[model samples]
Target: MTGEPVLLTCDSGGVRTLVLNRPHRRNALDAELWEALRSALVDAGADRSVRALVLTGAGDAFCSGADLPKRPSTAHPLHRMRTLTEVTLLLHELPMPTVAKVTGVAVGAGWNLALGCDLVIAVPEARFSQIFARRGLSPDCGGTWILPRLVGLQQAKRLALLAETIDAGEALSRGLVTWVVAAADVDAFTDDVTARLAAGPPVALAQTKALLNENTDRTLREALAGEARAQAVNFATADAPEAYAAFAEKREARFTGRWAVPTRTEDDA
Candidate 1:
C-alpha cells in the first residue's frame, strides 16, 4: 500500500502476503507491477522471519494476464519479458514455501504465476487458462517448464494450444492446483495451510523443498548423496535438537529460525 498501486503487502504470523492490487484490469501485470512484484519476492527471500508467502489478488480476479498496449512500444520487448522471467525464477527458487490463493480468473501469465508457487489453493468458482496462444504468443513466465512437469507433456500441450478456460475442480484433477474448496471456505483453508508451513522447521522445510524441486533432474545416486548432505545440515541446526526434545516431552517443537550449520572438526572425522 505504501508503494505502487499495483501491489499490497502484509506480514503476519511469519507469513508475508502479496496481493495484486489492480482490480479494474483484473490484476494484470503491467511493467511497473512486475518490477514491484520482483522486489517484494527478493525482500521475502532475504527476510529469515518470513517463513511463508501467499500471493493473491485484491479483487475477484486473481489476474487477467499482461496489460499490453494497443500499439507497439518503443521499449525493447525482450527486456520487459526478461523482467517477468526473473520474477518467476525468484518465486520458484525462494527458500521459504509459497502459496497462491486463486479466486476468479487466472489466465496466461497469471495462471503460470500461480503454477510457479510451491502450492496453489483455489476456490470452486476459480477459472484458469493458458491463454498465450490466443494472443498469438507462446507461454512465458516459466509456463512451458512447469506445465509439462505438473500435468504431463500431452496435457500441457492441449491446455496451451487450446487456450481453454478450466474451473478450479478440473485444475485440481489435472494436478495444476493442490486443492480446491468452496469460495466461502478458501480463506480459512489457506490460513490453516500457511500457518502450518510457517510453524514448520525452516531449515528442514527449505532443504526438502530444494530436494523435491531438483529431484527430477538428478540421478538416484546424486539424489541419495544430496539427501545425506541435507540431513547433515539439518542435524547441525538448533531445530534438530528442539525436535528431539519436543518428541520426548510430547510438546510442540519451537523453531527459532536459526540456521547454523556447524563446521566439522577433526574429532568428528
Candidate 2:
C-alpha cells in the first residue's frame, strides 16, 4: 500500500478487483504500471480461489492510455509495445471470467483493454474513443482484432479512422460495451454481475468462455467437436454432480472449484 503502488488489488467473495491507480494522469499506463498489471493478471489466472476479476480505475477516468515519457528513454520503445501485447492476451485468455468497470474516459489502449475483457459494464456518462489516430498512432493492445469482431469491419474502420468520441449508450448500441447504467447504479450493478459470475461453476464457465472466444477461428465441425470436448470435460468435474444433486434437492449448488476427475479402475471402466 506504500510507495505509490501503480496498481491496487482487492479480493472479496471470490472476486479479485484490480484498479489502475494513476489518477493524476487519468490512470495512464506507464512502463512500471504495465509490468505490474501484467504480473497481477498472470497471478490471478493461476489462482483457483479467484473465480472472477473486475478491472477499473481509481479516479473518474478509467484510463487515458499510455503515458508519454517526458524525455527520450534508454529502453527500446517496442519493448513496451510487446509488454502491452502480453497484458492484453493475458486478459483475453484468462480461464475465469473478467469484467471491465468503466466510468469516465476510456480511450486508445485503455478502451482496447476494456474490450479484451469478457464483459464491460459502463456508466451512462462513460466516454470511449479509439483515439490512436488522433495521437498519430495505429491501434494496439488487440484493438484492431477485437473491435472488428465486435462491431464489424466497416464500423471498426470508421471508428479507428475518425477517432471520434462516443458515449456509453452509443458504445452499447455498437456492441463496444456489454451494459450501460446510470453512474449512481454502476457500483451496485457491477457488484451483482461479478458476484453471479463468481458463484458459477468455474470449470464450466471457463470452457464456455474458451469455446465462444475461439468460435470465429473455427469451422462448424471444429466448433461442434470443441463443444463436445468442453462438455465432456465439464461432466468430469465435481460441479456437474453437485448441480444434479442440487436440482434434486431443490437448492442452490455449492461449487468448490474442484475440477479433478477420479481415475476409473478396470471394473468401473
Pairs clashing within candidate 1: none
Best by TM-score: 2
Model 2 Cα shift for residue 201 (angstroms): 0.5
Model 2 agreement with the true structure over 1-269: per-residue lDDT tens digits: 34799999999999999999999899999888999999999999999999999999988999999888999788886875789989999999999999999989999999999999999999988999999998899999999899899999999999999999999999999998999988899999999999999999999999899999999878999999999999998888899899999999999999875866877799996
Ten-residue stretch with the least lDDT total in model 2 = 255-264
Question: What's the alpha carbon RMSD for model 2?
Answer: 1.9
Each candidate's TM vs. the true structure?
A: 0.94, 0.95
Report model 2's TM-score to 2 decimal places: 0.95
* TM-score result, candidate 1: 0.94
User: Model 1, 1-269: lDDT tens per residue?
Assistant: 34547889999999999999998889998888999999999999999999999999978999999998778888887877889989999999999999999999999999999999999999988999999989999999999999999999999999999998998889999899999988899989999999999999998899999999999789999999999999998887899889889999999999875766767899999
